[model samples]
Target: MNNNNISIQDRSKLFAVRAIKAYTELNKRHFDDAGKVLAKQFLRASTSIGANLAEGEFAQSKADFISKYSIALKEASETRYWIDIMIRSEIISENKFSSMIDEINIIIRILISTIKKLKDK
Candidate 1:
């Protein structure tokens, strides 16, 4: 696989870029202290997904790739959780929450499928 192609690797790099931008915007919006904490956590978890995916691509074996991608999937789920909490707490709008959650869900599914396929090899 060509790592130079940002569109490859399950669109992980794209998702990470968008998530970082959104997190930056959210950080700059000056929410309450509690909201700020949740936002920071969410950003960290969301960005980790792409980082883990990149690592997985360079993994030495199928098992290693699966392990790394599994972590990415877990991080994506954590991001979704934080987004849901933030939205429910009124720290962020419903639209923003839904969009982020959808992206996270997509990533999670992609990672899960990739792991399963690798295991079957």
Candidate 2:
């Protein structure tokens, strides 16, 4: 999908897919069990960003939407944390981490802009 027209839900979904792909690549590289454990955490947090945003779309109230979106933003932040941990611990290569982080940052900016717009409304 075109980046300009992509919804937050779509962006977050892409993030999840990217996270899964990274995890699979790491597994193929024979990451240690500890690294695998971190990958699992990364996967959960990354996927949660989309899940929460999707759920929030049908929220019964504006307040509810804000709550869900807030949660999604938190998940995005958590995903970033996991990515940083992976890089610092040398579980994932710097190049891989940089790419992954760049994608997540896009999602983060989208979420922040969405939340700000919602709050303003």
Candidate 3:
């Protein structure tokens, strides 16, 4: 992801890129039985964050837009949960995920803020 200021869509796409790359490494480095399940969940939730946001761009109505954003937020939360599980389960290292954790946190916060703003408007 670039350091410059960017829209949520662009940021999310960049995040997805990083996440896909990490998913490949996760599969290679931690392919144990439980690790497979965790990695799949992680990939689904992480990618859904962007996929939902992208879908929201073409929402048919304001309510639909909020719904899609809400879904993205939910997926973001799930992604965090999977990450925590992976760390606790020793499927991945904490230090190695610090940056992605930071990125996901920012994405989650942004999703929350956007949802609130849309609802208020």
Candidate 4:
């Protein structure tokens, strides 16, 4: 789909997919037991971002939509924190986590803008 046509849901879904891939890669790297724990936490937070966005799409009211979007934004922030931990703990490389961080930031921006528009309506 064209960039203009792609919805926030689509982008969030893509972000979740990327997160899963990263999780798999982390396992392959043979991260210590602690790394495994962090990986699971990261996976949950990352995937939740998209799940919340999708749920918001069917919200019964504008207020519900805004609430869901806000949750998704919070989840996105949590995902970023996990990425940073992974890099600092040496479970993942700086270069790898940097790209993931960039993608998460894009999702964060979209979620913020979407929430603002909904509130203004």
For TM-score, the strongest prediction is 3
For 27-88, candidate 4 gives per-residue lDDT tens digits of: 78776789899999999999999999889889999898899999999999999998888889
Off by over 4 Å in 3: 1-4
How well does candidate 1 score on lDDT at residue 98? 71
How many clashes would you count in candidate 1? 0
Judged by whole-model lDDT over C-alpha atoms, candidate 4 comes out at: 0.87
Superior by TM-score: candidate 1 or candidate 4 = 4
- In the range 1-121, model 1's lDDT, one tens digit per residue, is 2233334355776777777798888888878889889988988888888888889879998888889989988988898898889888988888865766676677777677877888888
Model 2 residue runs over 4 Å out of place are none
Which runs of model 1 end up more than 4 angstroms from their true locations? 1-10
lDDT, residue 29, model 3:
78
Q: Count the backbone clashes (under 3 Å) in each candidate.
A: 0, 0, 0, 0
Error of 3 at 49 (Å): 0.7
Reference-based lDDT, each prediction: 0.79, 0.86, 0.88, 0.87
Name every residue pair that clashes in candidate 2. Answer: none
Which model is ahead, 2 or 3, in terms of TM-score? 3
Task: Give model 3's TM-score versus the native structure.
Answer: 0.94
Q: What is the lDDT of residue 24 in candidate 3?
A: 93
By TM-score, the candidates rank as: 3, 2, 4, 1
lDDT of 2 by residue, 39-101 (tens): 899999999999998899799999999999999999999999998998899887778578778
- Poorest stretch of ten by lDDT in candidate 3: 1-10
User: What is the lDDT, from 0 to 100, of the residue 95 in candidate 3?
Assistant: 97
